[model samples]
Target chain A: MILHGYFRSSAAWRVRIALGLKGLTARQVSRHLRKGEQAAPDHLALNPQGLVPTLEVAGQGALTQSLAVLEWLDETQPGPRLLPADAWGRARVRALAQIIACDIHPIQNLRVLQYLKREMGQEQPAIDAWARHWIATGLAAFEARLAEPAAGRFCHGDVPGMADLCLVPQLGNARRFGCDLSPYPRILAVEAACRALPAFMAAAPEAQPDAE
Target chain B: MILHGYFRSSAAWRVRIALGLKGLTARQVSRHLRKGEQAAPDHLALNPQGLVPTLEVAGQGALTQSLAVLEWLDETQPGPRLLPADAWGRARVRALAQIIACDIHPIQNLRVLQYLKREMGQEQPAIDAWARHWIATGLAAFEARLAEPAAGRFCHGDVPGMADLCLVPQLGNARRFGCDLSPYPRILAVEAACRALPAFMAAAPEAQPDAE
Candidate 1:
């Protein structure tokens, strides 16, 4: 298998954590997101969405979307599952992941920020505010969710699953943007627990080979 | 089964289509998003994410996130599967859905648009442009992906499943924003094909009881 990604891409980071938890390895190919490599013909052929973390398995073809890739990995591979056993538990975990992935992460992606600058002409301070505003609001809700009885040491059960994978990366981005973490106690604690696990640590953007 | 959702929420609309496709009915309750009913304490307790399209099965707990809820629906209920049988096919279909759900739809959501106004002080035209911009770009990629041999009448092989469920709502939003659709011919064709279906038509926002 081969993984096509850009280092700072949170979606790709999620896939890396899932693979690490599953103890799977694939050759890494970095597409410089800032350099517009993802939109190039070669990359678009792999993923028409022109996004990072397109995983090309030996036979299963190039898989885009980090969560979908994680699900496929969970289905095909054997090891620590990245989700809960019961259907309801899985739903809770997914809702947590989507809180970050769908609500927080998408709004602050690099391309969107660039568009804010180049197209919309949003000033730097305004853009940064936009980014921090979303991260803070979304994380607050996620932090509240983590305080629920269903939350164990990780985002769901004791095991680090899909929700944990998503939370860690978004928090990593939060810290990157200098967003205040003090408000989200539960999310902060979960991030700390996730950091203790080698899988989440290994998937951090700065820990990757392509990190700047 | 019951679904707590707003009639106009694209996220909820996806679940409505899925339920129809599976020959199932969710006892519906509308938390009018336009009226800020989703932020109510009762709704928040059921779904921590505070987003709509929370599916409550009689025996199982509530499921959130349109994609995850759709997957659980596919898994538990015996009917037309929302995902493809093969792994590669599933990946493709999922990628298609995420391009809309994870990429296009979230940024243009009512809350986010409201944020651009209340917090960022972005004027209406600027906010509308932001909405159109993301939808147009995301749909362009979606159109190219559909050009692949994999796309039949629906986003995948002729059946309307997860991807189709995602696509129609987005196109509806695009039309609402008065976005130019000529650039995405294949996407427009797929939207037309999906709109013709009774399942899609019945699930439309305008057809809902609280559409006003």
Candidate 2:
């Protein structure tokens, strides 16, 4: 498999964590997002959205979307399950993951930030504030959800699953944006637990082959 | 079951379509998003994200996130499957759905536009343009994906499933934003097919009780 990704992309990072957890190895092809390499013809052909983390499977073709790729990996590959076995538990975990993937990360990704700068005529400080505002708002909600009875050592029960995959990468983005993380103690606790795992450690942005 | 939702929220609309597809009825409790009713204490208690389309299942607690709700219904309910039976087909459907859900919709939702106007001090025209830009970008990608062989009358195969559910509502948003639809023939074709379905017609935003 060939994973087209950027080292610092939270979406790509989620897939990296999933790969490590599944004990699967894929050759990495970095599409430096800051340089707009993801928009090149080849990448766009593989992933029409021109997004990072397109997983090119041997016979199945390229799989776009990080969550979908994660789901596919869990369904087909042997691994520690990224989602719980039960229906309701799966719903809870997926909802938690979407809290980050759908709500938070989309609003503050590199392309959106670029639009704020180049198109909206926003200054660096304003752009930074924008990123921080969304991150803090989403994390507060995530923290509240973590206080629910279903949450345990991870985002769901004692296992690190899909939600945890999302949470850890988002927390990475939160720190980079200089957002205050003190308010999300539960999220932080989950992050600490994920940090203790070798799979999570190996998937960190700085640990990637293409990292600056 | 009860659905806490606002009539025009694309995310909530996705859930409504899923419910219709599943032949399930949920009592609608309108949380007026325009009036900031979604942020009220009661709504927040059920959904910490303060987002719409929280499906309150009897004895199952609130299921937040429209995709999660849709998946739960498909898994547990005795109706048409929202996802495909095969793993690869499911991944394709999901990745196509995320093109709208994760990338386009969040960037142009009410709160983000409100932030643009209130926080960034953008004019109404600029805000509308921002909405149009993201919609066009996402739909172009979506159109490209739709051109793939897997796309039949609906987003995948002849059945109107999860990807179609997301596409229909997002097209509503795109038209509202005045985006040029000429660029996406495949998307428009799929929308036409969905429009022919009774399930899709009933779930239209204007067909809802609180549409005013």
Candidate 3:
């Protein structure tokens, strides 16, 4: 499999952690999102949405969307389970993941920020605040969810799972955007625990070959 | 199951279609989003994110996030499968669904628009343009995905599956935002096909009790 991703992309980071957890290796293909290489025609051909972390499977072809790709990897690959075995538990994990992937990240992505500046004539401070607002709000909710009995050392249990994959990357992005993390001690602890794992550690943006 | 949702929420609409397609019934509980009822203490207690259609099942507790609820419904409820049986096919349907659910809708959701206007001082026209931009771009990619060999009458085959459930609601939103839909003939065709189904028709926002 070939994983087309950006080192700093939260979505791509989720996929890399999933692959590493599953003990699977994919050839890394970088699309410089800063240079708009993801929107290039060739990349768009592989991924219609022109997003990163598109997994080109050996036989199944290219799978876009990090959640979809991660779910596929979890189901098909034989390794530690990325989701819980029960239906309700799975739903809890997925909801937690989507809280970050769907609710927070999309609104704060590069394209949206660019649009706010170029098209809407927004200044940098407003954009930064925009990023912080969504991140802080979403993380507050995430922290609340962690208070549930289902949450343990990780977002699901004592081990890292899909929700942890999402939470860790989102925290990385939040810190990058200078969001206040003091309000989310649970999230911070979860991030620290995830970073201690080799799978999550190896998939960190700074550890990637594409990192500047 | 009881679904806490607003008539106009695309996320809620996705779950409604899922329930309709599965031939399952749920007590519909309306949360007036524009009036900020979803942020009420009771609603927030049930759904920490305060988003809807939260599925409160008999034994499973409240499940938030439309994608998570939909997946849980597919797994626990017996009916026409929302996802394809094959792994690759399921990935395709999920990717198509996430294209709209994660990428398009989140960026244009009511809360985000409110933030843009009240917080960032963006005017109504600019906010509408922002909605249209994400909708048009996402729909264009959705159209491209439908051109794949796997696509048939709907996003994935002739049947209205999970992707179709997501597609119909997004189209409703796009039309509401005054986006130009002329460029997406394939999407329009799929929307027509989906709307032709009783399940999809019954799930339309206009058919809901809370639609104002």
Alpha-carbon deviation at B101 in model 1, angstroms = 0.5
lDDT, candidate 2, A1-212, per-residue tens: 99999999999999999999999999999999989999999998999888899999988799999999999999999979999999999999999999999999999999999999999999999999999999999999999999999999999999999999999999999999899899889989999999999999999999999999
Tens-digit per-residue lDDT, B73-103, candidate 1 = 8877888899999877887888888888999
Between candidates 1 and 2, the DockQ winner: 2
Clashes of each: 0, 0, 0
Mind giving the per-residue lDDT tens digits that candidate 2 earns over B114-195? 9999999999999999999999999998998888899999899998999999999999999898998998999999999999
Q: Which docking category, incorrect, acceptable, medium or high, applies to candidate 2?
A: high
Ranking by TM-score: 2, 3, 1
Comparison by DockQ, 1 against 3, better one? 3
DockQ (Cα-based) for each candidate: 0.70, 0.92, 0.93
Fnat of each candidate: 0.68, 0.88, 0.91
The local lDDT score (0 to 100) that residue B131 gets in candidate 1 is 98
**Model 3 spans > 4 angstroms off:** none
Ranking by lDDT: 2, 3, 1
